[model samples]
Target: MTHEHAFSLHVPDLVFGRGALAEVGEHARALGLTRVLLVTDRTLRPLAPVTRVETALRDAGIEVILHDFVAIEPTESAIDRAGAAGQIHGIDGFISVGGGSSIDTAKGANLLVSRGGRIADFLPPPLGAGRTLGGGPLLPHIACPTTFGTAAETTGIVAFALDHGRGKTTLTGAPLRPSLGLLDPTALLTLPPMVLAANAFDLLSHAIESETARPFESRPAPADPARRPVTQGANPFASLGCREAIRLVAGALGPALDDPTDIESREQLMRAGLLAGTVFGMSGNHLPHALSYPISTLAHRWTAPDYPDDHPFLPHGLSVALAAPAVFRHLERRLPDRFAPVARALATDSVADALIALMRRAGLPNGLTAIGLSDEHHPALVEGALAQRRLIDNAPLTPTAADLAAILADARRYWS
Candidate 1:
């Protein structure tokens, strides 16, 4: 029997491939951005690629202001500081030059610059402070992704951390998407081995979660177009992206992680990340993201949280990877049929087992206990997952607290 599906997907003008960085100047000129904020971190500064990006833009006569202090897991303060810098520099456009963290920070800055208010104030909650964004006149934006995850280059979503918050929240709307996306595989060649692995894991999680999440069904009619949210239904085009994304991640992560210098692997990972981002962007994610929060927050003990969300302390991708096997098993029980595509995508006998093995091979922690979550943490984690209405609403089987508890128990066992 044939299934029917309807959809709408929005992607910025995209320039992807080798030597694509050279097109930056032309793309910027096309966007008519004279003053651009080059949002990036200090680590990328020594690379010729960073210089190349600026030079290309400069040769095109675009005035560039560099925000070099972008932290690993950006904070509310960082977003504020970046927004203030954009205002002071009179930046007319934004060009993000690093991974998910840098791109998300740039997106947050744009929201403030275009809409008006502290990034925290505009947040709706879980992370948003509930105050509306007041930045005016959205500016032209471009993303030059150097990492293989988040796909912030093309999406309208910007994940951000709130002061003293438990997890990440996002700024969503069409205006948040960049006008252009520049994905050059060459830029990703320099990623550290750990980061490369973590990012690959992130892409895998996106594909799995988006593919296996509950099927979309009709809900109460929206009050109006403005109030309508994307999650209320699923789009077919996004599902295609999800399938391709899974295939790419499974095929690419191992080679890329083991051989960071392998340019081909890096390029594949980048494309996989973009495809995964596209899928998750439209279909939205569910359980793994929710389960990842507490685990991510815990990761701050090992490294600073520099990404948009607070729990991003673990790197959004890594945290998601750590939680995937368990999440998928739970999901498979809820919707056995959904796993068919995931199994096919991963070329495994079964989706859950495929993901479990993939996670192991990727060096992702096998279970919560392996990563340091104790039994004491399970209850709070369950509560946190419960509070994630956005993700929970998308779950194939709406898990109760007991269900979450059982999954955590499984995770504990898997770790040992």
Candidate 2:
């Protein structure tokens, strides 16, 4: 394998345990926080983890202002509200206490409120004004993840979908990543089985995509240094993390999702998530993730189990899988010998087979139709997926418009 001799990695103070939520206060206080903006979502308002975090912060004499307005795929307006809450309250520290959506909301809000800018200004070029975030350090925030997907907690990038996410804008930089990520298995207890399974699929997919990411040497380096992305490519450090993440997800995700109270399984998935987040945070994903953007943005249908009625749509992980079964099957055929490790790590006869089985058992949508898309949606969906050239460029193989359409068309039906 082609690899770099010298590369750098940014790692946060990651704390993982069966009950890591209890340390949120001490971590905040250690940062010399007197007041903090506690960011979460409405769904988690009644959960035990939120209560524990509040008590810990308040008990430590830290004043807490709750910003629970976060929703899935938060819009610029939603995040701005969170930024306002943080800046207006005169809070010195920040904490995100839920899934990728909540933590990512805190990341975005913290960026604008502390550094000062509309969300568009910090996004990558052609999508936003392309501003840099390197003047100085921003606020210190702790990420307490309640879900196992999204790896946003360990990444230097925050992805927000606006304009119905026709194109997702990103806020990227080392400072945008959290200072600490707390993994408490207890927080995951409230997640329903299907919820756990869906996110775990995300974790598994992230690792697989990372492992197959195009090598950095193949691409021309960005002329503008600031435009350099966190998803650089497959590298030594990232591969190690992705490999382990795939193994952990394959082994433990089934049990954890099947039984939410299985702390041992939950702990393993958490570890896998952390590894997946770290790997994809830097290495990035390709086809499945690239297609997921349009799937999420263009989604007009409603589903409820984890998401509320007003906020209707499939979750990110589930959406990522709509085209995944076909995408991976195509990938294996195109790059037949390139993914031996992935095939083995998943511990299945076929990479796609294992993925299909997991999704099948989890009640995850096996097709675009299942998630509320039809033949009429295909042309628009393909156009949107193609627009994400940044991600598509990272794919193991370059796909034509026809190829992409075929994948979507194949995804429109059952997993077969």
Candidate 3:
């Protein structure tokens, strides 16, 4: 079987390394952004570097506008509000200064301001076919990643809620990808314990899932660098990244989350996040992300003060983590050979077992029951997951209703 694949990777002009945030001002100027709308949540507003991002922009002679109203887990309404504010302020570009929520919100605002439409109007498959942005031009975006999850910086997928329509709608367009990404690990040092844990798992899930999602392949010689390998179902670029990413997450997340005070551990987590992002960003996310959306949309849970919606308020990383173990076990059965590599990355005898152990060590919940999923919600949950074909389409094995039914069923009895 061909283990090597060739594919073009879509990533921003990534500026990585320690203290990369200090160069934010220069990067913004290079993009010719005269004025920038700084998007972040209130909790992060007080963060020194988060504040410094704006200061750095001004120091570089760029006029800065602050819109720190980004909720922890932002909804479509929140994104619309921020976008309107960006338009009103005439932002030349956008700079996101937090984790996935803040970055996702900033991406949404840029879309609305540049594309001119309701968030739902741009959902997948038909995104760039004929969409027109009423706004003058596509404003550039620069993502300042402070946390170690959701490589929102390298991706063109802007995930937002569809409040009245009942779930999330994602917009995917290469033009929507941020023009630049400044990844600085130092900024994450001050994150609260829970936030760190949640985000780490989000990174972990991306790595684990992406590693196994490559489509099946028949034995063939490794292709030349320019020729991308053909897998039965998975994207080649995504598969390679997934393997490396899983290894990094397995080694980095635990130490980083356990001791946030240690810069080395933090840096490793940031590296892991980037690796996972680069891998899955191209390969595409599957079941865990798909399943998490409905639970997020339907759950009555409320997150931190920054997140004020009742729209199933679980964090993206947390939601994905909740469904991971079950999903991994289910997929493992379909692709048993895939398990060996994941096991090796995870440094365990079994991939599914390793993932469950990792979740437990990270203090993540074992199953949906831990997050309030019950027998009553099984039908709806299954329906929601099936509807997320974008994610399920990349699953290692084609999932059936019976398979999903058992997964959710096992999830209920998992830890509770």
lDDT of 2 by residue, 122-186 (tens): 77667678787875767999999998887778987777777544555556678888889999877
Residue 342 displacement in candidate 2 (angstroms): 0.7
For model 3, where is the 10-residue window of minimal lDDT? 225-234
**Model 3: per-residue Cα lDDT at residue 26:** 93
lDDT of candidates 1 onward, in order: 0.75, 0.81, 0.75
- Top candidate on lDDT is 2
List where candidate 2 sits over 4 angstroms from the true fold: 1-6, 124-127, 163-167, 221-228
lDDT of 2 at 348: 74
Lowest summed-lDDT stretch of 10 residues in model 2? 1-10
Model 2 residue 320 lDDT?
82
> In model 3, how large is the Cα lDDT of residue 95?
92
Which 10 successive residues of model 1 have the least lDDT summed? Answer: 303-312
Q: Mind giving the per-residue lDDT tens digits that candidate 3 earns over 53-109?
A: 988898999998899888676677888889899889988999999988889898888
